[model samples]
Target chain A: MRFIFKTAYEQDIRLFKHGGQQFWYGLLGVALLAAPWVLDDYFLGQLTFILIYGIVGLGLMLLSGYTGLISLGHAAFLAVGAYTQAILAAKGWPFPFSLTAAALLAAATGIVVGLPALRVKGIYLAIATMAFGFIVEEVLARWEHVTGGNTGIIVGQLQMFGWTADSEESFYYVALVVAALVTLGVLNLLRSPTGRAFVAIRDSEISARSMGIHLARYKTTSFALSAAITGIAGALYAHKLRIITPEQFTILQSIEYLMMIVVGGIGSVHGAFFGAAFLIVLPQIVAMVKDYLPPAIGQATGLQPTIFGLVLVAVILFEPYGIYGRWLKIRTFFQLFPLYRRGLFRRQKAFMKSERLR
Target chain B: MQVLQVVISGISQGLIYGLIALGFVLIYKATETVNFAQGELMMLGAFLGLTAVTFGMPFWAALPLAFAGMWVIGILLERVVLRPILGQPAFTVVMVTIGVGFVARGVVTMIPGWGTDTHALAAPFKGELVRAGGLVVGMEHIVVIAATIALSTALYLFFRFTRVGVAMQAASQNQLAAYYMGIPVRRLNSLIWGISAGVAALAGVLLAPITFVHVNMGFIGLKAFPAAVIGGFGSLPGALVGGVIIGVVESLSGVYLPEGFKDIAAYILVLVVLVVKPTGIFGETASKKV
Candidate 1:
């Protein structure tokens, strides 16, 4: 498994632990930059949407995947950001200021939602977040002045310091840059003490508290930070579509965000991006394959969700570590071909039944 | 008189909610896992009943058939998807249920002609009304209340007296201990799930006359959940009381308060209950093992 030798202490903690990882990431960056030129307009739009989803997934991964908190209300935060940005942008607030306001407002709401975490965890916290999401959705739908009621509000074009990202290619580049910055920010945070503290909390609250980590502060901080990033994604999402609606941020959207992390591999930055791409692209894949299926199943718009739900169940049952974990397993098997034991990948019964370490 | 009318209607509405909340309590008590699919199960039951009626079956016969079908679905789900992942993390089990719900809704929505359109479930009562104290009460509401009482009493009797019910109680209290004592813990779990699903089906059948059979009706599970939370998640009787409280508040607020309060009344009640007593009105205090 150890491809590159690391002699210095810093080498072990570096962003890319090996030369191979750096090379792959460098190649990925180039591919992303050249994607607009290579792909058609339709695919470029999909990529932009995937990048935004990736940003939201990263935020959720921090709260749910790394911190062991379950929230069915992330979409509420997205709505807050979208509405905030839309309202501010319509009022002629500067682009950066409106975006900042969106993040701040979302973070404020996140903290309010996180307050329940002080008293509850697990299923109860999930319910609280769901309630929050519903409340936010209702408020958005009813508050006509801000959200334009059921009709929804139109978001203006993205303009920053005399630069307009009116074209699809330009907007795609904007999304890509924001996504890259957010990803790097998350990577940096994960290496910091706060991220480790989050992991510790996820593993065991009792042990984490014993280590003098303040539960209330850190949990809310994770919520705030996660919401802040999601808010940024929401702002970009609004600009990308140039229109926003409360209906767009439903519980289903929130579930999709959770699915991204779960399918990609929870508790990893790579998982967030991988899950985002997989989910965003899944509909296209299904559409392509639909023609080959029986006519009875082919025309159902609902089949995609059914397949999505089944995939979630299958991943949870068969490969709890998700797509990234499966990738690791395959790579390890190839790396140690002909020498690997069958039991090497067999799940321990104790781990299955015992308390989860997230 | 108006207040009394509101309370009566609220009680009937709450009873329907209670029936669904009862399913939540039964499953939670038996398995210690929240069944997010309960509402969808209710929707499936209603649709099944509608299908049976559409096929020329009498309303009375269709209702029982729907209940039985839902019971089978519940048992199958527990035996197949749930049993395989038994003893997994609570979060994983919860997510699986959520997935189950998503699949259930999707499958129902894909049922070709019947799936997309809303239809009326033609019950025997239909739109018969009774006059009482200058208020007209629908007979359907009375039937819902009556059925809820009958089912609750039957459930109470079963748990208190029947051998299987006693065994189930023992298993719920401590599965390992019950197993050691020669009880069929796993079988009891399936039985519990079946009963829960049956109850949900009954709720669906009872509610169909009032709301009409629609795919989106399962969203009522959203309201029912708050009822469960308000009553204390694990308490069966508490769930009923919680439902009543939520229903009465919503009914009154819809008339008295400003617009939109009715929709959020239950959720607000849940939030308040959680803040004041996180364990809920009837839930036992759970202590962590440090």
Candidate 2:
């Protein structure tokens, strides 16, 4: 009995400890793979949502979280992707070809939007990106032909290898596979030299440039990559919903994406997953509990944006590093066991140094 | 004659942008953050002016009071929303101000009597026009120019010799050195915010006649931001020139270019500036410290 107790504790510590924490992570990955089979139809739909948004959030994680280019208009890129796919597919193009076009078109638009980053940083860049968002939205509403205007158009259903990817099960499988592949691709890329360049530019662009990283090119390229990924997610989303409208790509949606990155923990790969899942699930959970709440509060939910504003302010104030970052820290604290490390407070002390960097 | 009329109108409209751009420059200089809520501030000021004038106060009588009220509001906003997030990454402050903007717009829309209808400001100088060589200009244009000049002169005087003004200049240029030199940096920052909001209120008061004091009048601030950027965000004089440039460019675009293009001219100007001369026409390149 004593030996078993000691063995279990050691196993937990070994899996949870230090840099080599991939063992339990591997188990979690296997569980996720098996999840779709056991999930009911409704749960399958929710999982589909998680997978789609997870891809979008992952793209954002790379841009805002890692590269330090805070884009408030990512939804515009998603629209570009969605519209491209929708328009092409509506015109009787193949799904596979439409998907490629969607990503390329979104990437092209991202390059033009990202041109502002060459000259500005931080707030100015944010404003520039926002302006681009507004312009894109205005174009969508007014152009009428390309976007189908405010009336919007339904996207043709996706097909794969003579099989319709229509049912919840098939959609979930497709999204899951795409999400998994993209997640893997991102994971691999982050370990590469290009990812290092992104981090370097983000930490200090001047220093990064000094160290022979081309600031303009890397920044723009990172933006293009982020946009392309988001575009893929958007294209997938259009097929999933069977509707493509300018409303799906509004500035508010862009802000929601930003909230996801912030809440999930900026710059962490795992953070994107948490952020996407939280944003998708939290509102449904709110709606569920909302029935039990008092009448006045329920009525106020009509006036209140509620969880959206509260979560944004709370995360930025209390958990600036985000839930994922905090989770990582707590896990680290236990692994470092009995070390009494307070991660957030230590971050505050280090802030002065960070302040001067900006 | 047609071209002359368009140019005059553009210059007149540009003055509105310049006024708001001045607001952007004023706050940006003192605090390194560009308040995205500046446009909403202008909107609030116009709405407040409407309140003052419509509630039986004369236009001139309400103008100064409105300015004073907004100045106080600016100070309060800085202290409450901005000051706490002062040391965070520029992104956090940006989002916070964005939230503040959202709340202000929501609150404004929530007001029962205020938002449901849009009423023209009972301007003391409504329906009046001036003709210069067949180019028609509204009396509002003359007032805007005269009032803008007067306001600019007063600001110039304040910065040139006044103890507080020069101290603000010192602090904005260098906080640590100003602090070492016995200038209260935080106080100066608050004061600058007050002045920015005050100036914005004055601009709104003048703009009420021309733009008719609607919730949408504040969109002028969006165009003005581009003016500040094109003029160099840090330079006060640059903001003025930038505003004029945007005004002229937009005016020309509306007349000469395809229809509906002028609405997007500000963004085009920003894109051009970002691509061609990002340091702006007047802003000096900031050297990176190792």
Candidate 3:
């Protein structure tokens, strides 16, 4: 194991802890920048989706994973973003302005939802968010003049100033830039006092309050920020799909977002990207493996969900830390080699913690 | 008369929601884990009843059989899937249940005869109607309301008088203390799951008459969340009351309000209730000591 002696306080909050991390991240960044040329258009499209989902995953990770607040209605924010972008685009607004408006609108809605969230915690908060999701869906469906109701509105191509991103490769670059900025922003935020407050609140709300952290302000800020990030992803998603519909943002879609963050690893920024890739790739993998299995199992309409459900269950049961956690374990096993212990990462035995009292 | 008719129908519909919510409360009370798959279990129960009926069994016999079968499945689910994950965060448990729901729905759809098609369960009182004082009521609705009343009464008595039921209450109140008192908390948890499943099965059998059985029927479980919340998370009778309130509001809105209000009336009501009274009507307040 390589250990770095930290002689300065600046080293504690450094974006890159060691030379190895900086080099690997730089290499990874280069690979992403070159991906459009190296990979086929089909793969590039999938990568773009991973970028979009990664953005949303980061948003959710900040809220649920770091802040200890769970939302089952993130898709509603995505809808807000998509619909706003679509509407503004139809009105011939600039791409940057539309995207900003989408984020702001979603943030506003998030605040509305977060207000009620202040009164509840845990499962109650989950249900309230879910109800909010259902209500938003209903509104989107009923507001025919603006949203086009069930028929859905067509989204225009990405237009920036005078130039238009008509090609898939150009769109990919746009998404890459936004994703990088967001990732860097999140990294910086985490090392700051605000992010520390979020982590503290997540670990123990009472203790966080006792330490003078403003609970209501931080919670609402987290919700607004999370929603804004997700909204940006929604704008990209709308352009990619070439259509915006109310049906696209449902409870199931929200669940899928939750699944991405959970499967990726909840607390880590890298986990969001890992989860986005996993979510995109899992379906493709299932489609490929379908023909190899027997007709009864393979051709069944329910096969995809069955596989997805089973995988989710298995992941929760075996590796609660998710794909990122598994990667960490593997890396540790190889690093420690002969001295690796089985109980190195064992979870502490937890008794049933009652929510009733809280 | 029309108002009464709507209210009556709403009560019956709400009763089904209550029945499902009852299952949620029972499981929540015992294990403190919310079962998101409660609706899927109800769907399975309906399918089981349908299968039994197709095989020439009477509806009466099929009902009990499905309940019993679901009871066993519930126990197995608790023992095999949930028991291993004991003491994990509530979020993990909730997600597991959601996964279980997906698997249940997927497996049901993959079944040879079930597939994606909707199937009507053959109730003995399929199309019969009763007219009283210039008001007409479907026999199916009456049967649902009657069955719910009977079940709720039996449950109330069970929790009140029976030793096992009292033991369950004690376990739910304090798991460690109950275990220390030799109440077999773990086993009781399994049985609570079984009872919850059985209750859900009964709800399914009753509900199948109003809405046909289908793979997607489990989606109705989402609506039950509002019901459970309105009644307070831990209160049994609160669930029933909440369900009825949601039902009446939905039914009334379908007729009185403009186009989409009916679809979201329950949610709106729940949101209002959450804003007004977060713990629900019967919810008890407690402070945690750190």
Candidate 4:
């Protein structure tokens, strides 16, 4: 019902399919820009965190969703970025320089970790990454001079070119601009040949290899790019939080990113934003519900992760495509309401076991 | 003498790791999906064992009671949670098991006093130390090592000689072929889950004397994962050997290396093994059909 009638290659590859999408996106953009002014300081801070997570989620989506490489140690990369920035910033490096340094350091680490991707994949890759995460955490905790050990580093206000995002309201704008730029950058990359190559690898590495896609080059590049993006997000997060610690970026944090991609929609760029917002907001929603429940149940922090687990299971079971997928279904149903068949959306099979790139 | 003492203690700890890794290998061999909840299952087993003992059940009786209870929980978990998504993607299955772990940990934490606090399991062998020609090891360590040997031998014989065990093996190798041959593959899967959970319970009971009973004991399950990987995810003997290797390495490193090296030694070993031999020590070469 919402078919796009494209007449040219340019039109077919345009970021927006039609004027309607552009309008909606523009309206959303305005709302984000206006958010700090409308919302209180507490909510504004939450928005900053969500944007940071969105950046992290985007990096993961590019690797896991697009490249079909699963990693459970993303938090380790984040730690690398954060520590790099924190250490450099403490030594009086400017904001942009430290941020770039962070991304470079994190990317280098990602490449080393991605070396295992050449030999193993799927669960083995996941285990390797997780092991890497633990190693980074151990190093962070023990290397007291550089990482400040368990005590952590306090990042001062971000300053660049005589401008400072000292206030929550001001910092919101900086995060907003960076997130928008990254999201747009990712969208453009997806339309590029490299993005198509990633999808090809994900769908079937054997087929992709036959089609002349260099597995090592593209795979490592994906890892490096993803790590760089996540590192930038980490650098932003460190500045926003003003204090950073190894404990903050644990394996659990990595899993939370995976949950975001799964719950948002696995293979879509929009899914990254949706997942980040959902996960960031879900805990707040849970905290609000505490008032109605009994004291013990209400106050229990463990309840949050319990609900996250249940949501993840429910999402995978019912809507494997996630909230975005469900939305598409509902929108399609409405568009073709009278002509919709009883089993219009029915498939021959529900779940396909993804083939690993061994 | 110090080295000998460490080796003795390491073997004991390693056996416990092997016990938990056995549970991991069991489920992976049968289902082909790593159950991230294996640790929480071990923790649950420990809690149930503690509860039974607190209710005046003797240590011996409490052990089996806990095993049986865990067996039921395992069966119910497979039936209710896992069965619905049996043929789904392996990633989805893995995630669901992680969810199961989260739920298990959350539910355990909500159980008031039992969930929040750490308590000694008060085993029959508690606090008894054994000395043999200048080597001193706790009686708990001796029991753990002995129990591991007995369990491994029993499992080996069961698989080699028992009809149902063979049936399970047949099912694991190729579920559809076994199914066509009139094997009840689904029921076997449930039994496998039950057995895995029971093994996890055994591990918890054995480990409780050394580490004490606490919700956080489930974290050891994460450590066991490295053991399973080092041993080969699917091989039982590999899991045992891997566990001892990890345990000994950890104990020795804790004494000889820098402060934090011991904590990460298992993971480092896993990374090295993955790089050097992706299939692990006893893992069969998995061929992918194009």
Candidate 5:
């Protein structure tokens, strides 16, 4: 194993821990930037979607993974962001301003949801967010005057300062830049004292309270930030899909977001991106494998959900740390070689911790 | 008379919600984990009942078969899938249940006869109506209410008087202590899951008459969240009462309020309840020791 001796405090919070990380990340960045040229338009479009979902995964990871707040209604925030972007775009607003407004409105709604977070917790919190999601979906459907109801509102192309991003490659670049910035922003935030507070709260709220961390403020802040990030992704989603519908943002969509973060690895930034890529690639794999299976099973409408569900169960049972966690294990095993023990990653069994009491 | 009619209908619909919520509370009370798949279990139960009926079984015979089948599936689910991950975080367990739900729904759809189509449960009570005191009530509604009452009474007695039920309660209260006391906690948990699943199946069969059996019918289980919350999460009677309240409010809203309010009435009520009394009507309040 490669070990680096940290001589300075600055080294502790460095974004790239060592030269190896920096070099690998740089290589990855170059590959992503050059992907549009090497890959066809269809693959580029898929990459753009992965980037967008990665942004959402980042937001969800911040709230659920780092902060320990579960939200089953994040798709509502996405809907808010998408609807705002579409409405503003229709009004001939500039892209930057409209995007900012979308984020702000989503953040505002997050605060509203967060108000209840202060009172409830665990499953209750999850249910509350779910309820909020359902209500938002209903509102979107009923408010046809603005949202166009079930017919869906058409979203225009990305128009930034009179430069319309009509081509797939241009849109891909836009998504790439935004995703990089958001990822960087998240990385920096996590290393900060604010991020530490979030981790603290997640680890133990009572302990965090005793340590002088303001619980209400940080919780709301996490919700707002998470919502804002998801909102941005939603804006990009609207532009990509070219149509905004109420059905697009439902409890199913929220669960899919949860699935993305969980399958990626719950507590790691790398996991978020990995999970997004997995989600995007899984459908393609399914489609490819469909013809190989029996026609009855292959042609069934429920095939996708069944596969997705089974995958989720298998992942949780065998590898709770997700794909990123599995990657870490494989890397560690290879690095340690003969020295690696069998029980290196075994989870300690404990009795169920009751969430009934505050 | 019209108000009474609405109220009566509301009670019947609410009973279904209560029944599903009861499943939620039972599993929750025992394992301290919410089964996101409870609704899907209900859906599966309905499908099983429909299958039994199609196979030349009587409606009464079909109901018990579905209940028994779900009970076995629930026990297997607990022992095979859930038991291994017992000590993990609640969120992880919840995700697993969600995965189970997806598999259940998907598998149901893949079944040749049950493929993404709405089905009617062909109950003997299907189109009959009873008019009493200037108010007309569907025979189906009466059957739902009667069946719910009978089930609730049976459950109440089971918990109150049975040895196994008492042991299950002890286990739920404190697993370690119950183990020390020589109670079979793990086995009890599996049994509790079976019982919960059986209850959900009963709800599904009863509900099939009113809504018809469809894959999406499980979505009504979402409304049961509000019911569970209103009645408090831990209390059995609370779940039914909460469901009734939600159902009545929804029924009233559908007629009195604008078109959309009915869809969200339960959720809005849940938010209000969370704000006003987070513990719910009969919810016990406790604080963790340092």
Candidate 6:
């Protein structure tokens, strides 16, 4: 298998040329599409949330992985969308139209936030976005007329031409389809000229600027684009929960979205889904073990938060690219079996050597 | 007279923020990474102090003990969570800290007795009003303001005069050179983190009286970030100046601005500060490396 895959020719870089990659991706896709049919209500609900986060993660992949601008404020965009859709839906607007408006609202806000990126880079940009998130939450809480003030406004069922999307099953399918479509859109985006420019900025902003790429324009556009996707997810979430409180849009949620990006693999398009799934599954598993704990322990201790912290710490300490990146490598290792390990190590060493040269 | 009182009140509260900013500066000085969880650590400190006080510990004893507890927590946090991710891109480390912050808040809220309920940390000084020639003030407020100033002065003196201080400064200025100079740079880094945590606890313990001690108190850290920016990210004194500026603006806004705007007063102040002087009042512009 290794012999057949290895090539001396530069043109032989076949990602899916081997049957294994195709088979694996195909099987994975099938499983995802089939998930709603087999899963119970609770699991379906959680899966829908994961898909929402995965959609947000796709945006982060573009901004952080592609454009190299770290956004701590993506969740703020999510909040903007969630709040916007809730308000619109409460006013008798169609669900589809509200969701679209949610994306547009987020994109508009994203442009405003992205303008700051023209001046600030990296951590500075992160802080600006962080501030933006805080400001958004404050607005949501205070704007009583539109946002139900501090109490927050609840959203009605997602109505698509008289069909209700209130059940976990319907939401599951909706989430799956939306996630797939958004993922496709994002992957395609990465293949475009703007995507390459984002990659160039990520590698070296000065070189990118030198290459005549409008750094500010692309950098900020990444924020707008990422925010729009996150907003769409937020809109879906608001509809799913039937509640859109300012509390739901805390800065903490922003951190969770970031965790998705990091845990799934910072730059990979698929990393978001992988990261969101891990987070969602871990908590569910934790909850499932709840009954087994001693009453005293269960009553007193916050095992859930403690577990989250430990998982985050563990992930950062070892697999920085997250489980997804590691899984990719592990799959390749198995595909090549014993013979492939040598090739992997060789590639890694060369990669490391080149980094040192840089 | 009322306006003066408000300004004084703002300055005093600002002192506490400045102190928090001091911790931020101290950590940033040693390690370039920002400690997003410092607020949570501070909240933990006040809670610990509350526990200490309720356990019949004397104020002095409880304060110092709580400070020590915070220092240990800080060190443990760095050793367990942060140390491993030292060389990862700044974004990864920041996100880790942010996660750590959430975990801290969640854990604090989860404590059986705490239950997200707000409680007062019984202060030694009764918040009795003192009429200083028609200018009313709380005695406790005076104490907090004084203590922050005194702490800031001590830090300034220590940094200027002491051997360890100078070495730490050297580390902050250039890590490679400090390492080459036989300084235990990594140990120094841990110590800085520890010290920063202690300072944050002190700020929290002091601030807990005015704002009730609860799980959400950790969020005051968000407000403190604006203080850091206002003072200039790298400047210690600027933190003091920035905090006071934000405090006064917040107080005045709450009094005079339309209801909703006061909630965003600190952020607006930060924006103004950033616009006026991006590096902050006392910050020097940094040159990009070639």
Docking class of 1: acceptable
Q: Which of 1 and 3 is ahead in lDDT?
A: 3
Please tell me which predicted candidate would have the highest lDDT against the true structure: 5
Is candidate 1 or 4 superior in TM-score? Answer: 4
TM-score for the first chain in candidate 6 comes to 0.87
Q: Write the per-residue lDDT of candidate 4 for residues A1-358, one digit (tens) a residue.
A: 6778778989978999899899999999999988977999999999898899999999999999899898889998888888888778777788789889999999999999989888888778888999999999999999998889999999888877678878999888988988998899899999999999999988888899899999888999999989988998998988988999989989888888999999998899878888999988998899889789886766665788788888988887777778788777887778898776746655335323323212
lDDT of 2 by residue, A1-358 (tens): 0122444545542323433446677777787777767998888888888888889998998898889999988999999988888888877777778888999999999898888887777766776786788778768877887788888878877874567776778778788888988898888778778988999988887789889998889989999999999999998998887887778787678888888878888888888888888888887887877667674554342223445555666676667778886786787677667774664345452121122111
User: Which candidate, 3 or 4, has the higher DockQ?
Assistant: 3
Tens digit per residue, CA lDDT, model 4, B72-185:
999999998887776665677777888888888777767766756788988998889888899888998888888887887787677678988888767766666677789887
Worst 10 residues of 5 chain A by lDDT: A349-358
Across A198-272, the per-residue lDDT of candidate 5 in tens digits comes to 999999999999999998999999999999999999999999999989999999999999999999999999989
Assess candidate 5 and give its TM-score to the true structure. 0.98
- Candidate 1: tens digits of C-alpha lDDT, residues B60-108: 9998999999999999989988877765556777788888888887787
Error of 1 at B123 (Å): 1.2
Query: Model 3, residue A314: displacement in angstroms?
Result: 0.9
User: Which DockQ values do the candidates obtain, in the order shown?
Assistant: 0.41, 0.28, 0.60, 0.48, 0.65, 0.32
Model 6: colliding residue pairs: B231-B238
Question: True-contact fraction for model 5?
Answer: 0.62
Off by over 4 Å in 6: A2-19, A89-97, A160-168, A339-358, B107-117, B161-163, B287-290
lDDT of 4 at B110: 72
Please give the CA lDDT of all the candidate structures.
0.85, 0.77, 0.89, 0.85, 0.90, 0.77
lDDT of 6 by residue, A99-204 (tens): 8999999999999888767766655567777888888888888878888988888788887777887678887887788888898788767767788889999988
User: Please, what are the lDDT tens digits per residue for candidate 6 over residues B11-127?
Assistant: 877777787788877776556667888888888988988888878887678888888999998888888887666545567677788778768876776666665788788887757
Across A199-297, the per-residue lDDT of candidate 3 in tens digits comes to 998998889989999989999999999999999999999999998788899999998888888888879998999999989999899899989988777
Total backbone collisions, model 6: 1
Candidate 3's residue-wise lDDT over B1-290, tens digit each? Answer: 78998998888789878888888888887777889899999999999888998999999999999999999999999898887787777788888888898899889877888888889988999889998898887998888878777777787788788999888777766666777889887788899899989988888887898889998888888988899899888787888899999999999999999999998999999889888899998887463645
Across residues B158-273, which tens digit of lDDT does each residue of candidate 2 receive? 77779998787666555666778998777777888888888888898888888876555665676787888888777767777787888888899998987657877877777778
